[model samples]
Target: MFSYRHAFHAGNHADVLKHTILVHVLDYFNRKDAPYWVIDTHAGAGIYDLRSEWATKRGEFADGLDRLLAAQAMPDAIERYLQAVQHFNPDGVANFYPGSPWLALQAMRGRDRLRLFEMHPTEIEVLRDNLKREAAGTQRQVAVYQADGFNGLKSQLPPAPRRGIVLIDPSYEDKRDYRHTVQALSEGLKRFATGCFIVWYPLVQRREVADLQRALTRLATPWLHATLSVSKPAATGLGLHGSGMFVVNPPWTLHDALATTLPWLKATLAQDDRANFTLARHGD
Candidate 1:
């Protein structure tokens, strides 16, 4: 069952990194005249209310986007991400947060198409409603499905749009999720080798993260991995200390973009000594 709900962690440090890179990728895709497709596996409610009980319960944004917003002389990548979020919050008072699907919609053009899959019924309803409320009148095309994202991805592969991005942002609530990500990504690459893939993972214990990286590296496809750790090593066993993103067939500009933005993020959001950032490419 799909028990993962993004409401509790919207706008956290991980979202900051994932969405920043997502915006850049979408922007790059838009640069071309040919139409492109965006498929969001594990799509959550398109928008989130920071003041809502779920969000306010942890107030995660306070440690993430909030800090990034307060930082001075922001990098261009971060500036673009903030601009997108600002689009949702016209008054500039951070009240709402846009998940990947909504963020992708904001950057989509008339020729672009969006395919979103959310297994959670309530989240699926909210996702549809939010899209209707926020995307009305836009010429961009969208298709949402209330089904398993893993299965949804396989069904939609090699979309009418031969060119596009496939985003995999599973909740990772289940240990099996890690294995599922690798399996799904391996299959996706086989079907759409040219499509860009972005996989987001939380950085908790060293062993888990290392195993994930090892599995990703084993994929018989070229990929790039980037990570931004914002907290010190937890005291033995604790909560999420940081997060990372693995990009398969990443845009050439993404490397430079993250290089410029990650340091700023580390300095602005790091809560302890283990905070740092790393950029690497595996498989040419």
Candidate 2:
């Protein structure tokens, strides 16, 4: 489906979880001297205006970044993610929200490379324009492609530096996207078994999501799976209840940091008794 525009939901709860994990992953990569690549398979427009008509109509950020921005005394991991967001808003306002590509670029070093894929025509153009403006015409640091990330990511595996992170999170507007995500990861692991992998998924009422989780667990690797549910399933099964991030080959420090951070997120963002959190790990 070409209808999925991330701008409408930018900075929503899913983004809070996805970007938290993404920042942690990128931070870990920066700790090493060897350069690492960040491959974002579903890079949306690098930036989103919260005041825009599209975002104003839904107001998803009101419950997501807005809540986080109001809180204080966050755990270091959570604080770090928000600090990265702060870079875009030096004027001390929340009129804009950084998408995944923007957050990734902010955290990545000049030596590190970025390969972004966005199949949507409008998003690709916006993605390029945003990078150009943000990079101040020095966008060679990142490469943006208007292509299917699933197939396009194949050649990037086992990157020259032999260290990197592959972030795969499609809109899942098409059922086949679920299968495609798993297949891409499986193939990627074969080529770069030690590289970090992060997958973001919505907590929707769907069997394909369940199947995707079950299939991911079948991969024999050290992993961490964390989720935050801000509300019970919608009565009509129509909205995103929450979201999750499944990480493979995660940093040792990451699992522990999130263990402390998830509870605070659940409490601060809860909608009802249905709000809850989970942090599970294997082969640690």
Candidate 3:
């Protein structure tokens, strides 16, 4: 039983980092005239209401997107993400937030295709309604499923699309999720070696996170790993204070974009003194 509801954490520090990179990737794909497909493994509700009870309980976004939104002279990459967020909350009230599906839909050209998978029944219903409401009168194709994202990878890979992007953003609600990420990503690379793959993971303790990185590096895949830590070590050492994104077959321009955006993220989102960034290529 999957009980991870993204509503509570939508637009948090991790979401900021993941969605920023995602937007840049989509932008790169849009530069080409050829059509491309995007597979969103673990796609949550297409949109989120920041004013809802879930969002207001802890108000996680208050420390994430809120900081980004308040910054001046933002980098272009961040500007694109913030602009998309603004589009969803036209009143400038920021009452709503767009998840991966909605963000991909905003960036997709008419020829592009999107495949979204969500396992939660209630979230899936919200996802469908959100997509229908936002994509009305448009021919841009979309396919959504209430199934396991890991299975969707095997079933939908190499999606009639020679070129594509597949995003794996699991809730990590279970400790088993970490191992599942490794296994699923291994299979995905075997099936779609050339497709761009983005995997997001949180950083709680340095040792555990390092082990995860070493495991991914052992895959011997050509990939780039970028990390942004938002706080100092916790006294209890039990909460997420930082996060990272692993990109397989990243676009040539992504490294440069990260160089510019990550420093700013650290400055804006850090909750304590331990904030930093790392950009490295794996299996090069």
The alpha-carbon deviation from the true structure for residue 102 of candidate 2, after best TM-score superposition, in angstroms, is: 1.1
Over 179-215, each residue of candidate 1 has an lDDT whose tens digit, in order, gives 8888899899889988899999998874766888899
Question: Which digits, one per residue and each the tens of the lDDT, describe model 2 over residues 239-269?
Answer: 9999989999999998889989999999888
Q: Give residue 210's error in model 2 in angstroms.
A: 1.0
Local accuracy of candidate 3 as per-residue lDDT tens digits, 1-284 = 66778899988999999999999999998889999989998999888999999998989999999988888878899999999899888888888989888888888887889999898989899888877887784434898888999887889877786889999878776666777888888898888899999999998764656777888877677888999888876889777888899999988889889999999898889887888888888554
Count clashing residue pairs per candidate.
0, 0, 0
> TM-score of each candidate?
0.95, 0.98, 0.95
Where does the lowest 10-residue lDDT sum fall in candidate 2? 132-141
Residue 92 deviation, candidate 3, in Å?
2.5
Q: Evaluated with lDDT, which candidate comes out highest? A: 2
Q: After aligning candidate 3 to the native by TM-score, how far in Å is the CA of 41 from where it should be? A: 0.9
At residue 32, what lDDT does model 3 achieve?
A: 91
- Candidate 3: count the clashes: 0
Top candidate on TM-score is 2
